[model samples]
Structures are given as C-alpha cells and as structure tokens.
Target: MAEKRTDRALDRTELIKQTTLELAQELGFTKLSIEAVAARAGVGKHTIYRRWPSKGALFLDALLPADAQALDIPNTGDIEADLRTQTYAAVDLLGRPPFGPLYQALLGEAQHDPSVAAALNERFIGPQAQRVRARLKLAQRQGQVAPELDLDLAFAILSGPLYFQFLIAQEIVTHGYIDRVFSALFAGMRPSP
Candidate 1:
C-alpha cells in the first residue's frame, strides 16, 4: 500500500539521520564522508544523493535537532526577551557537536565547493536568521523599535557580537554578554520622544 511505502520511507529517513549523527559523533565532521554515511545507513549512495545534492547538504543538516533548526522561533510579547532567547538558542545550536564541527568544515569546504557554500547559506544561515527577522518585524509593529530602524543592521548589531565571541574570538558568550548587548542595542532602537 502507498501508506505502507510512505511509512517505510519515513523509517529509513530517520534511520539515516540517526546513523549520520552517531557517525559524526564518532568520526567528527572532518573525517566523515558520504560514502561512509551510505554504508552505515545500509542504503545506496544514490538514496542520499536523491534527497540531498551533496554531503554538505545532508551530513550536517541531518544531524541537527529540530529545535536547533530555528524553524519555529517564539515571538513572546517582549521582543527583547525573545531576542535574548533566540540568541541563546543560536549559541546552543553552534556549540553542539556535529553542527559545530560540520559548520567549521563547511566554511573551509565552501571555499572550494560552491554548492557547499550555497547549501550553507540557504539551509543554515538564511533559515536561522528568519526567526530573528520575524522578531524584528514584530518589534517594529509594536513600536518598540524606531520606525526608521534598519532591521538588517539591527540584527547584525544584536547577533554579530555573540557570533564573534563564539566563532571568531573563541570566547565564551556569558549571560552578562547577552544582557549588556541587548540593553545597548535596545537603547539605540527606542524611538526618540
């Protein structure tokens, strides 16, 4: 039956995801290969290729837990609180295994593989950023943010430091960092009386 086939397909998909995660945990992202994933999943290489164009598309993304995907970021009444929540969530996403190393590898790989770069931009950064963008839009609507506020700059200002600390400076993003960053940006965003 079609339903049976669908169920079976879903099962295989999950199996592959779990296998990939386990393998990445054991192998780390640099040593992980698509051929290994296929072998471990007990599926043909083409099965994965059919779903994702490259290891860049499948390997890192398959292992990301659903919440870490930023698919449904909450928009609580307080935009400041929501931004803080999402910033912490983003930190959590990058700090985790598989996602962290894979992201690092992809950044290196992307220099040579344009497809990998596109996948990273499309699947990873752009999607996660939408949550923050949505929060900014809401703030604009609620008048917490100045009407003329540049949302992109606002987003970058708010998030860039956290990422810089984590990804570039390789420093800890303490809770104090979040509070200070938000308080400063919020001051800049509030409309002039």
Candidate 2:
C-alpha cells in the first residue's frame, strides 16, 4: 500500500538522523561527513541530500529535539523558582556531552555561514528567546516583575551572562554562579516596594 512506503521512508529518515548523531558523538561535527552518514545509515547519499541541503542542516535536524516542549519554561507561580528551574535545565543541556560539543561546533560554523546562522536562529535560539520573553511577560502579569520592564532586555540579561561564562570566559556554569546571577538579576527586575 502507499502508506507502507510512507512508513518506510519515515523509518529511514529516523535511522539517518540517529546515525548522524552517533557519528557526531564519536567524531564531532568537524570530522563527520555525509558519506560516512550514508554508509552508517545504510542509505544512499542521495537520501540525505533529499532530506537536507548540507551537513549543518542535517546535524541541526539531528541535534534539536522534535518536541517543542523540550524547551518549555515552566510556570510555578513563583517566577524566580520557575525561571531558575528552566535556566538550570538549559545550562545542564548545554553542558551535556555529544550535544554540548556538537552544538558549540554548529555555533562556530554559523559565524562564517549566514545560512547556518539563520537556520540555527529560526529553529532554536529565536524560539528560546521568545519563550523567555513570554515567561517574563507572565511574571509581569503576576506582579513578580516590574510592569514597565523591557522584556527583551530582561531576556538578554538572563541569558547573556550564562553564555558569556560558558563560551567566552571559559568558566564552569556552577550552581553557585547561577544562584548569584539570579539574585542580582531579580533584585534589579522585581517590582519596587
């Protein structure tokens, strides 16, 4: 039946993505190749090309979770607790092996490749920024944050330091650092007495 072919195609796509990630874990992105992916996935190189345009595109698809909920910022009434939970989760994800290094490699690649940068923003970074802004808006509605606060700036304030510590300063994002950041940031953003 026609449906059988569709199911097989979906299975093959999943296999290709899985193989890509496994290879990326072993070799890292710089050494990974489409030919190796095809060979590992037991599919022709044409199959991967049909699904994605380049190595970056293929890895992007493989790296990001299919579920949007994976990146959700929770709402637990206490804005500080909620945001801290989400922030901790984000930091944990960014520090995990295979994914962490692979994602960093993608970011490095994006600096020179506009298309890759655009895709990374569209698929991952932009959504996360939107989610942070949305959570801040909710906190504002609940009187936890200043009503007049610029949420765009709030988002930057929250995420900027974390990345700077990780990627720029090359320092570990310890729990103590996160706690300190939250304490300082919340002091500035909270509603005035």
Candidate 3:
C-alpha cells in the first residue's frame, strides 16, 4: 500500500512537470501561472505549492534536465575543440522553440524579480559557470590555457558575447559569430611562448 502511494505521488509530480512544460511552451513563461499549472495538471494549487515555492522555481525545475552531463564540457584533449563543441551545443539548445523562448522569458523576468534571479543563478547559471571554470582549470594545467589566466574572467570572456547576442540582441547565435568569438578568445588565452 505504501509502495502504491509512493508511485502515485511520483506519477503526479511527473504530471505536474510535464503539464508545466506544455503550458510554458504554449503560453511562454511571462504568462505562466501556478494556478494555471495546477489546474492543467489536475492537482490542487497546494500540491504544487508543496513541491515548488514559486512559478519561477517550478518552471526552472521543469526546464532543466536532472542529467548534469547535458551541459558538461567534454575533454577532447584539445581545449579549443572542447569549448567550441560545448558552445555549439549551448547555442543549439537556446535556438530551438519552446526551450529558447521560454528560457528567454524567464531571463527577462529574472531581471526584475530577485527571487527568480536567485533561483536562476542557484540552479542554472552558477552550476554551468562552475563547470566551465573547471574545464578551463583543466586546460590551464594541460598547458592549453595560460597558467596565469583568471578562470572566472576567462569564463566571462568566453560567455559574455554569447549572452549579449542571446539576450540583449535577441538574435540567433550564428556559427560564424561563435567562431569569431573563439578565435579572439583563444588568441588571448594561448600560453605565451
């Protein structure tokens, strides 16, 4: 009996997350509401509230995968190749429908909502940044990156232009632009002779 109850609860939670994703795709994040999610999922508002404190939190949970490797930078024995591979993958993720638009909407909302901002940073941005920094540190030790380079600054330099094009310019991140950014960044990051 207890096993059945646990299965039911897990099923309900999955339902809630799937319903939230569907609604976010249809309505976008700005218009997504907890009430609507609960109604759509056929659960009480309190059920969702028990699971997630805010719409942003719930949306974020629904948006990202539990598999951390989805965003991990591969060690290909070449730092530039690895970075480019990861950047291309990231651009592909942000360029697709539902994912791209919904993520963009949440990013826009985070600008004005501290809770949302904190949640985004805590769950998504911070973890991703940490992974990038770790990859850079590995490259530094491998003699691919300059030993004296600041990992945090290196991360910002690599990601900043992509974010500018992604969020500010609201333009699709082209392969050409990505190549240019890497070319310039690698020029500076390469170990001195």
TM-score, every prediction: 0.78, 0.92, 0.92
Instruction: Please identify which of the two predictions, 2 or 3, would achieve the higher lDDT against the true structure.
Output: 3
lDDT tens digits, residue span 143-172, model 1: 888889988888789778886887678776
lDDT score, residue 167, model 2? 79
- Residue by residue across 1-23, what tens digits does model 2's lDDT show? 99999999999998999999999
On a 0 to 100 scale, what is the lDDT of residue 1 in model 3? 100
lDDT by residue (tens digit), candidate 3, 1-193: 9999999998998899899999998887778999999998899999999988888778777877455445778899899999899999999989998788888888887887788798788778898899889889999999998999999999999999999999999999988899999999999999999
User: What are the candidates' C-alpha RMSDs?
Assistant: 3.1, 1.6, 1.6
lDDT of the candidates, in the order given? 0.75, 0.88, 0.88
Give the number of colliding residue pairs in candidate 3.
0
Worst 10 residues of 3 by lDDT: 63-72
Candidate 2 lDDT for residue 80: 90
Clashing pairs in 3: none
TM-score for candidate 2: 0.92
As for lDDT, the candidate ahead, 1 or 3, is 3
